[model samples]
Target: MAIGKLFIGRKVRDIRQANGATQAQFADMVGISTSYLNQIENNQRPVSASVLLSLAEKFGIDITELSSGQNDRLLSALTEALSDPLFETYSPSLQELKLVTQNAPGFAHALIAAHQAYRRGNEQLASLDDRLGAAPSQEVTPYDEVRDFFHFVDNYIHDLDLAAEQLATELKLGEGENYAALSGHLEAKHGVRVVRGEAGDEAIRRFDPVGRILTVSRYASAPTRDFQIAIQIAQLAAATKIDQVLKQANFRSEEAVEICRMGLYNYFAGALILPYRSFLTAARDLRHDIELLAARFEASLEQVCHRLSTLQRPGLKGVPIFFARIDRAGNITKRHSAARLQFARFGAACPLWNAHQAFETPGRIIRQTAETPDGVRYLCIATQVSKGSAGFRAANPRYALALGCEISYAGAFVYADDLDLSNRGAFDPIGISCRICERIKCTSRAVPPLKRKLVVDHRVRNPMPYEID
Candidate 1:
C-alpha cells in the first residue's frame, strides 16, 4: 500500500501562531527554509517526515494531532447538511470540504449548527400543524432539546466518559466482572441498599434517595439489574461531576437541564460498565460480536451495541457504527450514528431496512448488505429483544435493535463471514426516509418525495400513484 502525503498546513500555522512565533522563526526551529515552510503552511506541499520529527522533538507536539483533528466529524456533518434539498443544485467536492474544515473549522461548525437549528425549527412547525386545534407555543419539547444536544456532540461526552472510567478503576472492577461486585461496591461505598423487588407496573428501577434504597424490578434480567444499579450509582455518586458537565451546556429550560442530567448519568452508567480500553480491546478480539461482548462485559445486547457507537476516544478509536432501536410500529425509540448514516428526525426509517423485518423473527439475528440512496454500503444486523414481564397479565416491552457499519469495516465483523462483498446485486437499496429518498422507482415508497414533483397520469399504471420527477 502506498503511504498518503500528510498535509498539516493549517495545523502548523495554528501551532506557530499559538506559540507567538513568526513564520521565519518557526521555520528556523524546524530546520526548514522560510519559503519551504510557507509552502507547507499554505498546503502547496506536504509536511516532510523530518519536519514531523522536528515538531515532536522541538515543540513537543503530537504528530497524530496535526493530521486527525475534527476533520472527519466536520466532513460527516457537512455532507449531511448539504444533502438537504436547498443545496441540491450545489455540492462541494470532498477536497473543498477538507480545505474548509482545515482552514475555517469554526465557520464550518457554525454552518452545521445553523442548519440543524433550521431543521429543528421546521420540524417544530410541522408538528404544530399536525395538532389541528392545539395552540402553538414557542417552547420546544425538552426531550427534543436534549436529543439535539446529544446529536451535535455525536453521542459521546469525553469528560463524562473519562470520569466514569476513573470511577470504574476505583471500584476495583475487572474485565468480565458480574453485577455482584458492582452491587457490593454501592452498598459498601455509598451506604446504599441494593434490593430486587417489584418496582410497580411501569417502573423498572426506583431509587429512594432519602432512604438510600435502590429497588430494581424482580422481572429485570441480571444485566438489566446491573445497569439499573449503575445508573443509580451515577445519580448518587457522580451527581457533582454530571452537574458540572451540564452547567457548561447552557440549556434553555430547567426541564431540558434535568433531562440532560439523566442522559449524562445514563452515559456514565454505560461507560462505567464498559470501560473504554478494556471494552475496545475485547471488541477487537471478538470481532465485535455483540453476544460475546455482552457476556464479557456482563451487559445486555442493546447495551453492548450502544457502547459500540460511543467508541469515539480520540487516539484509540473503534470501528464507527450506527445503533438504533425501533418498536414494532416502526417508531425509532433510540438512535445514534458514528458513521455517515443519519437517521430520519421526524419519521420512521426506510421500510426496506432490515430493522423493520427483525420483528418478524424474534431472537434471531438478521444480517443484510444494504446500500443507502447515497451509494454508501453497510453491513446491517438486527435482532428483536423482548423485556419480560413480572406476571402473565403485564405487558412486555419489545423492540428491534439495529447496528451497522460501513462496508469497509465489514471484514472486522463476525456476522460478515461467508457473505459476498463484491456482488453488488446482494446489496438491498435503502434510504434515510421516504420523504427525502430520491429513488423514483422504489415500489416500497409510501409517499412521494417532498422535493420532487409528482406527474399524475390516469392512463399510465405504475406501482405508485404518480411518477416522481
Candidate 2:
C-alpha cells in the first residue's frame, strides 16, 4: 500500500499451489476474482495491503511477506505469532522490532516464532478443560505448575538458606552491612568472580560456567549484581536436585520440564540472594521501605520485590503478596504469588495500579490501594528497574515490578503506612477479573472480565452499573 511496495504475488501463488489450491480455488476461498488473483501473482497489478491481508487470512499466511516482498516462511510465521495476545504486551516495541528487522532480522524472526510456539502450547493446554470435560488425567494448570515449583524450593531450603546464614556469620555482617559482605564473601569463598561489563545485546547477565565468572552489566547496582551471582550459583548447585524434582513431575516433554527446572533454579537464586528470614526482618524493621531495603541489601528495587513474594514458608509465611513484573507498555513478564489475584493469561494488565505509574518515576517507588469488584482490596507498591544488555539510551528497556497484599495485612509491613488508607482517595479501587469488572465507573478497563456478567438494576444507576447479582 505504501509507495514502491514490493509485490510478493508470485510467492503467494507458489505457496498456494504448494498447498494444492489453484488460482480459481484460492480466489474463491479469499472472496476475490481469479483474474485479480492472476494479476497479483504475475506482479502485473499491485496487491493492495487490504488484498494481501485477505489473501493471508485465506492462505493462513502472514501479511509481512507480501509487504516486505520476502518468501521467508519462518519470518511470516513469526510475524503472525507475535500478534498473539500472550506476546502483544511483552514483545519488543515497534521501534525495537524495526531495529531487529534492520540489524538482526534472523534473531527477530526466531524470537517471534519461539514466542508464538510458546503461547500456542499454553493456549492449547488452557482449552483442555472444556475439550476434555473434567477428565481425571489433566493435573497441571499454570497454577499447579507454580505451586509445585515453590514446593520444590520449600523442600530444598538447605543450600540457599544455609549459605546466606553461613555467609552472614562468617563475614560478620552484623546488623546493616551483610549484603556487601555477602557479595565479597561469595567472590572470595566460592571463586565466583563478578565483573562489570556492558549489558550485552541479548541478556542482562551471562554466567560463564566454564570460566566460573559472572559478567554483569555496569548498569546493575551492587546488590543486583550480587543477586545475579547468587542466582547463578544456586542454579548450578541445585541443578541436580531441580532435575530430580522435574523428572518426578513426569511432564509431557523434556523441553517443558527443562524450562520449568531452569525457572525454579532462578527462583531459588533470588531466594538465596535475599534470604527470606533476614529480609523479612529487615522489611518489618524498615516498614517495607523499598529504597531502604534496596540500600541495605545492595539489590535493585525489582530484586527486592521479587524476593518479597517468595516469603511463603508454609506455617511461618510472611504476608501473602501477589507479585507482577511488567514492561513500559503494561506487558507482564513475571507473575507469582500466594495472594488471591487474577491476571489475564494472554493480555495486558489493569492500567490503574502503581506498577504503571512507577514507569514514569523510573527508580522511585509508587504506592496505591485498590479494591477489586469482588470486594478484595490490596496495597500495591512498585518501581521500575532496568533490563537488557543495553544502556539508558533508547535501547535500554525498563521494566516494573509490583508487589501487593490484601488490606488486612497492611499493618504487617511498612509499605504505605503514611497514606490515609481508610479514605476513598487513599484507595484506588481495581479488579482482578478484567472482563467481568462491573465498575462502569472505571475508565481504564479494556474489556469487562467475563465473570462480571452484567445484571440489570432498574431502580438505581450506581457508579458500578453491574447487575444486582
lDDT of 2 at 39: 80
Clashing pairs in 1: none
- The top-ranked prediction according to lDDT is 1
Candidate 1 matches the true fold with a TM-score of: 0.83
Clash number for model 2? 12
lDDT of 1 at 291: 94
Per-model tally of clashing residue pairs: 0, 12
Q: Model 1 residue 8 lDDT? A: 66
Which 10-residue window of candidate 2 scores lowest in summed lDDT? Answer: 68-77
User: What is candidate 1's lDDT per residue for 43-79, written digit by digit as tens?
Assistant: 8888888898899898878665565435655666676
Q: Write candidate 2's Cα lDDT for 1-469 as tens digits.
A: 1324544555667777887988888888877789988887765676676676776666666553344322222333334455455543565554444334434545764575356447556666788878775433332444435443443242234444555555444555535564466556657767777766764434447877678777776765566566676666666566676666576666655556766766666766666656667788888888777778878776677777777766655334566677888987777877765564545444577777778888789767778888866566788888787764344454767788888887877886676668776876667777643543457667666765443345767798865555424
TM-score of 2: 0.58
Assess candidate 2 and give its lDDT.
Answer: 0.63
- How high is the lDDT of residue 182 in model 2? 52
